[model samples]
Target: MYHYDNYDQTLVDERVAQFKGQTERFLAGELTEEQFRPLRLMNGLYIQRHAPMLRVAIPYGLLSSRQLRMLAQIARRYDQGYGHFTTRQNIQYNWPKLEEVPEILEQLATVEMHAIQTSGNCIRNTTSDHLAGVAQDELEDPRPYCEIIRQWSTLHPEFAFLPRKFKIAVSGAQKDRAATQVHDIGLQLVKGDDGETGFEVLVGGGLGRTPIIGVMIRPFLEKRHLLSYLEAILRVYNRYGRRDNKYKARIKILVKELGQDQFAERVEAEWAMIRDQLLLDQAEINRVQAFFQPHPYAELPAEDAILAAHKQCDAAFAAWFRHNSVAHKVPGYRVAFVSLKPLGIAPGDMTDRQMDAVADLAERYSFGEIRVTHTQNLVLADVRQSDLYELWQALTALDLATPNIGTASDIISCPGLDFCSLANATSIPIANGIQQIFDSLDYLYDLGDLRINISGCMNGCGHHTVGHIGILGVDKKGEEWYQITLGGSSANQASLGERLGPAIAKEDVIHAMEAIFQTYREQRLDDEAFLETVRRVGIEPFQERVYGDH
Candidate 1:
């Protein structure tokens, strides 16, 4: 994790103080709601359906155990006793008092954390692969680049107020776990033909009301010009992106209207003007890269005898190990996912106690660090294979050991009408209903690598556009209806899902989903994943099964 320098600390401290004053003024009637809207939003505070929700940025989804404990304390003392981990890999306090939000910001600053750029029409948090340095397939760790962007974008005067919120994601791994293709700016680290590292840049990809996979703006961007090129793109968007309509303001919309070639040409022209001025030297790249050097991993056997024995003895532990643990770059180590999608709880809601316990577990087992995934789970990225059993036990005690990492039960969902005022229907209940129906582990494993993402509305906060099976909530007259999409993915070959058919009534959503699953099971070839089957046969079969007799 990148620790803050004095400059970083000072900047955050000053911002906290400034926001404290702004919040006080709002409460004292010095600023009306209209006046305070942008200010509060800039600080990641939102007036939700029932109370004020404060989203705290977990930059690139990285957290130290100390920071995690502080977040637990904030959740315990300020809001309700839990916080919701979001698709952006941030945490949200849904019940925080408006008056105490400034205090929360102050507390977050003490741990090198802040809420700045987390909301409003500005460059949001720069996210990356949660398994960054530890992934076996990675060409290089992307976090250094992510951190560089974070520092550059944070309150940059030039981009302080864009037409709409801009999101950037970087993926250095062969697999695109960071969902880079669906971001405003997606940078995939690639080795150039000359054997030098560079980027494959994608632009105009986003999910909201209009979903589109990003077009490859640049097949290869030199490392030295990363910042300058990003600045150029932002400049182009800021100057030409729609300001008249919020819905049409995203960079994706601009790219769409102008066409990919024209958009790229505009960015290239802008880059030619400023690229030389912002060119990064090797030293600057090295300076940022120094923070992400490999962890001091011990030399251990490829297989843990005790762990193997424990797996043989405990069926539950074996299930968790099979599903929740991923291979690490180093031998004898694993990246363990702490599943937040239990049977009844909201998908990513972690109680304060669970947070504190996970912090403790991270300190004891994974070098005191935690990584939040875009799928709304936590990652202990350096757990030794020898210690897997004990860690699994501890996580089980905290109800965090759900053996359904990529299964249908491991749903990705947004805080829909239950919390978000922009939502038309409730997403949490739909997610819960799906989880309950797919409760059997054997059935889930049979379904194989199926993803179910839900969003209350078209804001696409749940990333429903990328799920293997996407459930979108809609308002029909006075009734709640759900729309389904199939074959959407944010992985290596990113693509937006296609709508299955007419919206099903909310009461029939579970049945429709069941039919979809059944269709997959019956239609799939040997060991083919749900996504593979969807692409092979198309959504017509599943759609017919779901809506055939309706």
Candidate 2:
């Protein structure tokens, strides 16, 4: 993780002080609610349904043991004992009092963290692959690029206020685990034909009330022109993006209106005009990149007798290996997943003790490295095979090892109506009801890996657009009803699932899932996953089973 320089520290201190003054003015009746709204939003403070919520940015989801401890401290002293890890790789506290937020900001500033640009219609946090710097397939670490954009976009004079909020994601892995395609700007790091590192940029893709997969505007953007090209795209969006309606203000609508060819041409024209004039300095990129360089790692043997002995000795260790362990670059090392989603627990909720345990485990077993995945889970990046048994032992004590990493029961659920004011219904309980019915891990493994994503509202925070089994909550006649979508995914080939039928009542959700799974079991070919089966035979059979034919 990058430590803050004195200049960086000064900037954060100044911003915190500025926000404190703003809070005092608002409370003193000098600034009206309307006048103070944007200011508070810029500071990452939101007025939720019941109380004010504060979202603190965890840049690129990288947190040190000290930082994690501080966050846990903040949660315990200020709000509830738990914090929700969001899809954008940030954390939120739903019950912070308005007066306490400035103190929270000062606390966060002490640790080279803040809430700047976390909200409002400006560039938000720049997220990267959570498994950066250690992933085998990465061309370069993505965190430096994220930091580069963070510095540039933070209070950018021209783009401080735009038509809507903008988000950007970067992925260096061949597999798109970061959901790059659904972001406003998605950057895939690639090597040019000339062998220089560059970006394969995708533009205008977003998920809200409207969902569109971004178009590939820049197939191979050279390294030098990165910022210039981004500025050009933003310039075009700022000038031409819709302002008439909030729903239509996103850049996706503008891209759709222009069509792909015209949009590409306009971006190219815009880029060509200013590529050299506004290029970010080369020394700056290198300086930022140097901070994120991979640490020197010790070489070790491929085979570990300790890991083998553990697997041979225990049935539980074998089950965990089947789902949680992933191959790593080093011969003797591996990446192990610690499922935050224990059977009935909230998806990404972790207690203070749990956080401390994880921090200790990271330092003890993984060479002081921890990764918080975009899936709202945690990863032990370099857990030596020899330490697997001890790591599992410690994690088991914390309720972090459920042996379900990407199974039917390992659902991706948002806080929904429980925390989000925009949500139509409660999402957590809906997921709990469904999980209770599918509690059998043996049955889940028998059915194979399935993605069951649930969102409480149409905002798509849970990424319902790409789940293999997507459930979106909608209000029907003042009752909670879920609209299910089948065969969606966020991978190399991304596609939005189609609706099964009319929305089903909350009470009927688990039954609907049973019918849907049973349909897949009956219709799928040998060895096919849930997504393949649904794609092979569209959503008809599932729809028939769920809604009983027309």
Question: How many residue pairs clash in all the candidates, one count each?
Answer: 0, 0
| Model 1 steric clash pairs | none
Worst 10 residues of 2 by lDDT: 291-300
Error of 1 at 438 (Å): 2.6
Model 1, stretches more than 4 Å misplaced? none
- Residue-wise C-alpha lDDT for candidate 2, range 452-529, written one tens digit per residue: 889999988888888898899998877898999998887779889898888888988888898888999999889899
Q: Model 1: per-residue lDDT, tens digit, 1-550?
A: 7999999999999999999999899899999999999999999999999999999999899999999999999999998899999999999999999999999999999999999989999999999999999999999999999999999999999998999999999999999999989999999999999999999999998998999889999999999999999999999999999999999999999999999999999999999999999998889899999988888899998899999999999999999999999999899999999999999999999999999999999999999999999999999999999999999999999999999999899999999999999999999999999888865788888888999999999998998989999989999897899999999999988878989999999989998988998999899999999899999999889878888857
Give the Cα lDDT of each candidate.
0.94, 0.85
The weakest ten consecutive residues by lDDT in model 1 span 437-446
